[model samples]
Target: MKRLILLLVSLPLLSSCSDQWGWYVVDPTTKTGLTNLKFLLSGLEQTVLMSFTAIAISMVVGLAVALPGMSSSKGWRRFNRVYVEVVRAVPILVLILWVYYGLPQLMGISIGVFGAGVLALALSDSAFQAEIFRAGIQSVNRGQYEAARTLSLNYVDTMRFVILPQAIKRILPALGNQFVYMLKMSSLVSVIGMQELTRKANELVVTEYRPLEIYTILVLEYLVLILAVSGVFRWFESRMQSDER
Candidate 1:
């Protein structure tokens, strides 16, 4: 709060300098680039779409990978270790470039801006989500497995009926946090012309030539988005807590 107050107080001084040659000012809703909010809205929608698709795909992939990774077999465990390490080690920018540019050449097929963006982010997020699932599943008590065994439940039945329910509760918060991270990372998709919020902001900056104010607006927009996500997470947290009681 203090930082926000200081930032708001300083905006006038920072934006009032004589050297603000590249800065341009226009009516917030009447500027050439921002003449219609439709463009911004379209961009924001694309961003949300990309994040949603990516997160959904990542959740599925993470669960699939995590099951094998968490297996007792040495080979599966080793493969999981390498998979997580390699993916997490690579930078998101590099992953984006590979998916957007390299993928078409490799497969002789093209995924458009939206497809490529979702694929890239999902691939990256899967690594993290796999770890989340692994940790969640492992956190279940040994006694839970023993109880399921006493009921003559097989591994699959045990996981579906006994393990996953508890694991899901523990991992809900982490998944929500991952969704927030994925939302911000979707901005990187702009590099391949996905036209998400950041990309629209760039176009606005170029046309209106107001980097400072435009970027500030963009930051505030993202802050709102993050806060909304956090609010939803809090609601889920409350519900989960109530269930636990």
Candidate 2:
């Protein structure tokens, strides 16, 4: 993985040696390039913040949705099905646009770009998260539920203490993947003027007139961010597996 990252990072530099490429715009050695680089990296904080906030919201909302679907009542199951189906069917870009532009009109309240982006991301991802949680919960051994009932635990207590812990462990990887997905999807919020990584790159491209060079760095930024996130997830998974032993 390190080798792959190094190779990817080096590709643009090698190509930039040609006269056609304007690598000077992002060259770390010069003052202007360093400033431009900093300007681009500035968006990193917003991107990470939005993605994390959205994913966290989606997890909670998804768990709530999943619980209803798990209920014995047909009405609740139908509600879950309708919600998941409708939400998952919508394109995330369209959802973001609607949340940013249209939702405020309906609610009669203003939402900032960051709030709109986060809300849209969370709502769009909640459907998938619901399925992941449901599968993970269902995968828990039936004997575990039986043991909770034998202990005279109520449904809430059984889920909170006995079921959720096991299900969360099973679902960690899926959650991690969703976080990664959220990171990528957050770029779409750029369309609504959320000043994220892609937005920074786009702005720089307009001023520098070097789309190729600027966008190459943008790609690298995402690549590095995603690789780092994946590494963290893998470390957590390993630690959890070791603890299970």
Candidate 3:
């Protein structure tokens, strides 16, 4: 965390060296640079909001999909396999386009840009989330289930009290990775005019005519966001381990 903070703090200072790199476009020392900085940062809120909403939706859908795979019924298991295989095969970009353009036509409904992006991201990510959830749940010891039954616990009680807690603990790291992945994937939505970080950068690039400088800033922005998320998860996993001990 300290390293991340230091890196962010020093980025602006590098521009002070010279304007040879056209870093002046984003140089916080100048008035135009300060203006451009605010413009670029303006999209941060939307990007974070969109990623969180999509991740929440995907979690619910993924758990629903995962539960069936663990069921005794062969039909449910088959449905789970089919759903995961099919969805994971489709490219997210294509899915986003279809949701934006194709779905409204097919369903006679109006799916706006934000809605389409959320749907596409959630659907695309749910497949991977289901696999992680399925693995986590299945990783629980078989004896745990028998022990729960020995305690007069029913299926639902057993899962709620005994199984899911352990499974969630085991899957925390995987879930964190998926969130970081979702954040990066959310940028693809900017292709459809969602005004996310990438979209804002592109718009600024056109007017400022400084793609090199603007995109350098864009990469740094994501690098900081993703690195911070990664650091937080590492801390969380360590905290969970300490609590277990």
Judged by lDDT, which candidate is best? Answer: 2
* lDDT (Cα) of model 3: 0.90
TM-score of 1: 0.88
Q: Between prediction 1 and prediction 3, which has the larger lDDT? A: 3
Give me the displacement of residue 136 in model 3, in angstroms: 0.3
Q: Each model's number of backbone clashes?
A: 0, 0, 0
Instruction: Write the residue-wise lDDT of candidate 3 on 1-114 in tens digits.
Output: 688678767765666675645777877889999999899988888898888999999998998999999999999999999999999999999999999999999999988898
Q: What is the lDDT of residue 234 in candidate 1?
A: 84
**How many Å off is the CA of 182 in candidate 2?**
0.8
* lDDT of every model, 2 decimals: 0.84, 0.92, 0.90
- What is the Å distance of residue 39 in model 3 from its true position? 1.0
Ranking of models by lDDT: 2, 3, 1
Model 2: lDDT of residue 28: 85
Alpha carbon deviation, residue 95, candidate 1 (Å): 0.5
Model 2 lDDT, residue 229, Cα: 97
Clashing pairs in 1: none
lDDT of model 1 at position 60: 92
Task: Report the number of backbone clashes for model 2.
Answer: 0
